[model samples]
Target: WLLFLGITLFQIPRIASQFKEENWHRISETIPVSEGTMLLTLDTQAEDPDFNEVSLKIEGTADSLVTLEKEFFSRGKTKAESLENAKVLGYQVSVLDSLVSFPPGFDYSAMDVFRDQKVNLILKVPYEKPFLMDRSLLDILRNTIYRNGYKSRDVREKNIWAFNEAGLVCLTCGSTTDETENQDPNEDQTEEEQINREKLDSLSRAKFRQRLDSIE
Candidate 1:
C-alpha cells in the first residue's frame, strides 16, 4: 500500500504538466455574403468554461459574407481527450435575411463527457461592411473593451482596428495621446475620468460582494 501511494504521487505532477499544455486546432472558412447588413451571432449550449475572443478586419474586397478564422482550444488531461471532447461539440453557421448566425450545437444528453473541459475560440471577421451581432458576443466584447479602458456610450460605436505593421495597437479608453500628455498636472480630473475610475472600482467591490454572499 505504501509503494502504491508513492508511485501515484510521483505520477501526479507529470499528469498535471501534460494538461497544462493546452491542445488546439485552427480552421478558416469563407461563406457567400447576401445583400444588406450582416448579423453575427455566437450561440453556445455547453455550460463549460469557454472563452471567445472575436475581432474584425476592415480592409478586403472579396466575394463572401465573411471570412471565419477560428481557433479552438481544448482543456483536458491529454490531447486525445481534448480532441475527442471537442468532436462532440458543434458549430452552426447560417444566413437568413441578411442575418448570419453562428450557434452552438450538440446533444445535451451526451455532455457528460465535458467535465473539466473548456473550449476557447478566437474568431476574426471582415469589417469592411456593416454588421450586427448577438448579445452573447456583445457581452464578451464589452467586458474586454471596458477592461481595456474604452468607455463607449454604445457597443456599436466600438470598433476593432486592423493590426498595423508595428504590431498590435495599444488599447485605450478612447483617450488620445495628445490629450493625455497635455493634461495639467495640478488641475483636477474631469468628471468623465472620475466616473471611469469609479466604474473600475465597482468591479472589485462587486466581486467581493459575491464572495460574501456565497459564504452567507
Candidate 2:
C-alpha cells in the first residue's frame, strides 16, 4: 500500500508536467494572437466518453478568427491530457460550419504556413457592414456550432458557429437574442439574389459568391 501511494504521488507530478509541456507547444504554433488576448481552458468531467469533458473557448472579433483557426489546427494534434495522444481528433471551424477533418497525415507545421491565406480570406469580409450569408451557408455554420456543444441561441450572439471531426455540433453563434424578434426570417429570402447583385461592393460580392460556390 505504501509503495502504491508513493508511485501514485510521483506520477501526479509527472502527469502535470506533461500536460503543461504539451500545452506550451500547442500555444507556440498558434500565431498572431491579438495582444492581451486571453486563452482559457475548461474541463468538465462527464460520464459519456464520446464527448470531450474539457473544451477550449475563445472570445474575439471576427478578425481574430485567423489566429483562432491556426491554434485549433495546432492544438488539435498535440497530445492533451484528455485526448490520449491522438494526433488528430474531431474539430469544428465555426466561421463556415466547415468540418476540418484531420487526414491520416495532417501536419501542424504545414498548416501554419497556410495561415496567411485563411487570414486574407477573412479580411475580405467587411466587418463594418452587416454581411448576409446565404441561408445554406448559415445552416452549415449553425450546424457546426451545434456540434461543438454550444447552443444555437448562444452562437446567434457571436454570429458564428462550429463543427467537429465527426461532423458533430460543438458550438453555436452568440448573437443578440433579440435578433429573431426584430427580423422576419422571410424578409431576406426575397432580396437575397437582388441584394447580392446590387448592394455589396462588386469585388467583395464576387469573392463572397466564389466562396459560396466552393462550399456548394
Best by TM-score: 1
lDDT for each residue of candidate 2 in 1-216, tens digit (9 for 90 to 100): 999999999999765554342321232222332322112111112123222212322222334233333222222223453233332333322222222211111222333222111110111111222222223233213223333333444433234322111222212121235433221123333466434423333443345346557779
| Cα-based lDDT at residue 6, candidate 1 | 100
lDDT of 1 at 130: 43
Enumerate residue pairs that collide in model 1: 33-65, 149-173, 150-173
Q: Each prediction's Cα lDDT score?
A: 0.44, 0.29
Which residues of candidate 1, in runs, are more than 4 Å off? 1-21, 41-65, 104-112, 134-136, 142-152, 156-216
Q: TM-scores for all candidates?
A: 0.45, 0.26
- In candidate 2, clashing pairs total 28
Candidate 1 residue-wise lDDT, 1-216, digit = tens? 999999999999976754654465556676566754455555454343233233332223333335655444455666777665555544446657666555442222444443343333344433234455444555334233233333333233232221122112222213323332211221254677655545543443354346447779
Count: clashes, candidate 1:
3
Give the top-scoring candidate (lDDT).
1
